[model samples]
Target: MSVGSENLPQFALVGGKGTGKSSLLESLVGKDFLPRGATRAPLVLNLRKSDCQEQGIFLHRPGEKIHDFSRIREEIANRTVILAGLVRLSLDCQPDNFVEQTKSTIMEYISKEETIILAVTAEGLVMSQALEQAMMVDPEGARTIGVITKLDRAQDIAMAELDNKVVPLKWGHVGVVLRSEAVKCWKY
Candidate 1:
C-alpha cells in the first residue's frame, strides 16, 4: 500500500557530491534503491515500512507508477518525476564554487519549519557547505542532524569535529563507516 505524500514526514538530505547521501539512504532502506552516479535533480523517495519480507520500489509520476529500477536513472536525469514525498537535495561540495541558484533553492527548503535537515559531511573534511547552510538557517540546530560519513578515513581533525570541539550542534553528530566492499553497507 502507498501512503499519501502529505502524511509522510519530510526529510531533506543536504550534502555535497560524494558525501554518501545516496549511500546513506540506500543503507537505511537496506536495498540499492537510488541509482549510481551524480544526482542531477532532487529525488523524492516515499519510503513505507512493509510487513512482507520482500522489498519493492516504485517511481510515481502524474499518471503512472513505475516499478522498474532500471528506468529510475533516466527519469531522474530527465527531471520527469513529480517532486513529492521525502526529498534528497544535494548541493555542490565547494562553498567557493556554490552557484547562487542552488544556494537559494537550498535556503528555501531548510528554512521551512516542517522540513528536517540532514547536514551530511565526510570525515577528514574540516567544513561542509551543507552543515554551514543548516547552521545559518537554524542557529540552535534544533531540526538539523549532523551525519558524518567515511569515519574510517577520519584523522585527528575529524576527532575534534566529532567531539563537538570544532562545531557544536544541539542535535549532535553521528559518525558512520563503510564496512566492506562486498557488502557496501555502513556501520553507524
Candidate 2:
C-alpha cells in the first residue's frame, strides 16, 4: 500500500520519565535505537516486516520549530508485535499545561483512527494523576490502553492499583516484567 493512501494503526506511548518507555520499545523492536534520556519531540515508528532493518519517523508538532531529526525514515523488524508510530511523552515534573501539547497531538492521531497506549510503571501509581486525566479525555477507552512496566519491582501494588481502580484504566492494565540487567550472562 502507498504511504499516502494507507492509514496505519498509530500508537502513542504516554508515560512519566524513567518509566522504561524506551526500554519497552527497544525490547519490542529488538534493538536499542531510541535515544535515551529526555525525549524532546514525539516520534513515529513505522514498522514494516521483521528483518531487523531500521525504519522510523520523527513526527513534528504543529507550529513547532523543525529540527534535523524532525523527519526520519528507517527499515527494521522483530518478533512479537510490530507497531510503528509509537508516540512518547515525558511528563516528569513538568507543568500540567505541558501535557496539553501531547494530548492534542495524540488526539489528532486518534481523530485519524490511531491508537494510544499509556505506558506506566507500578511505582508510577503515585505519579499517574496526569496520565489518568489523559486517559479520561478518551474515557470510553476506545483509543487508549494502559501498560504497567517494571512489574517485578511492584507486583503487589500493580495488582492493587488495577484491581482497586486506583489508576482506573478504561482499557484495563497489562503487566510486564523485564529480566534483570545483571543476569545478562548465559548459564546454559
Candidate 3:
C-alpha cells in the first residue's frame, strides 16, 4: 500500500525534559539514532515495516530531501524535519517560556485528536508537568496513555501508577525502565 493511501496509527510522545522520550523512541526503533540532549522541534518518524534485508531511511528537512543513510541521524539531530508518521514532541521544562511553548504545540496536536503518550518520571508521577498538561487537555483520559519512565528508580511508586491507584486513565499506563548511562556498562 502507498504511504498516503493507508491510515497508519500515529502516536505522539509528550513529556518534559529528562523524561526519557528520546530513549523510548530509540527503544522502539531498536537503535540509538536520535541524538542525545534536548530537541528543538517536534520529530515525525515515518517508520515502515518491511521484510527486505536493507530498509531505506530518509530525512526530509525544510528545503532538502536527504537520502544518505549515514547522514540521516545527524541531520535529524541537528535540525527539524517534517514528515508524516509517528510524532514525538519533547517538552523542555526549563526557562519557563519554553515549557509554555511546548504546551501550546502539544495542545495543537491534542486538538487534532492525536493519541498522546504522556511520559512521567516514576519518582515525580504526582507532580509531573507532562501529566498535568495531558490531564488538563484530556481530563477523561480518552486519548492519553501514561508512560511511567525511570521505573527502576522508584518501582513501588511506578507500580502504583501502573495499577491506576495514583492516577487513573481510560487508556491506562505503561511502565518502562530504561538503563541509564551508568548502568549501560554493567552486565546482567
Candidate 4:
C-alpha cells in the first residue's frame, strides 16, 4: 500500500445521494465528515468555526488557487485525512477552462494518494465518463472502486434490468443499495 506507513488503509467512496455514502464514511472513520459539495470556502469557514479541533478533513473548493494545495498536502502528510468530497467543476461552472483545470487538479493529487477515499456523488445520473477519465488519469491503476447508489429510488429501472443491465456490470465493484442486516463487508 505504501501509504501512511502506520495509519489506516485509504479508500475512495464515489456514488449518488441517498446511497448512504456519507453515512457510511461517518460510521467508518468517526471524523472528517465532509458532505457532498464541500467546497474550499466552506471548509475554511468550518475550520475557522472549529477554532482548534485537531482532527479535520481538507477538501478543494472550486475557484481556489493551486497554491492552496499546500494546506491540503500538509494535512495529508500529517495523516489527518479521512475522506475527500470532490467538487466537480462542471456543476454551474461557466468557463470551460476552469472546469478542465479543476479536473486536472483532481487527477494530479489523486495520483499522490493524498486522501484515502475520493468520494464522488453520482446522484441518479451515471457519471461514467467522468469516472473513467479519473481512473484512466492514474496510469498505474490506483485500485479504482465505486458504488452505484440510490437503488431504492430507482423503481423505474425494473427488476429484469436490475438483474441483467445493472447487476452483471456492477456486482463486483458497484454495490446496490439493498436494505438487509446480513449484507456487510462492503469495501471494494
Off by over 4 Å in 1: 1-8, 49-60, 68-70, 77-98, 124-126, 179-188
Report clash pairs, candidate 1. Answer: none
Question: Please, what is the TM-score per model?
Answer: 0.68, 0.57, 0.67, 0.43
lDDT winner between 3 and 4, please give it: 3
Instruction: Report how far off residue 119 is in candidate 2 (Å).
Output: 4.0
lDDT of 3 by residue, 1-188 (tens): 46641244556677766778778776766765666666545555455445643333343433344444346577666554332112243334334355456567677665555455554555746788677777777887787777777767777666667776667777777777674742221111
Instruction: List candidate 3 stretches off by more than 4 Å.
Output: 1-8, 49-70, 80-99, 122-124, 181-188
- Backbone clashes, candidate 2: 9
Using lDDT as the measure, the top candidate is 1
lDDT of 2 by residue, 1-188 (tens): 46651365655566665677666666666655554444444445454433554434323222232222223212122210133222344344544455566667655654455556555554745467436645556756665555667777777666765552665555666666543452121110
lDDT of each: 0.62, 0.51, 0.60, 0.40
Candidate 3 vs candidate 4: which has greater TM-score? 3
Candidate 4, run of 10 with poorest lDDT: 40-49
lDDT of 3: 0.60
Clashes of each: 0, 9, 0, 10
Q: State in Å the error of residue 135, model 2.
A: 2.6
Q: Kindly list the per-residue Cα lDDT of model 1 for residues 1-188, writing each as its tens digit.
A: 99866555567788887777877766666666465665545545454445643423443454344455445545665552333212234234434333555567778778877778889877532468888889888888888877787766664446666665466666666667643443232312
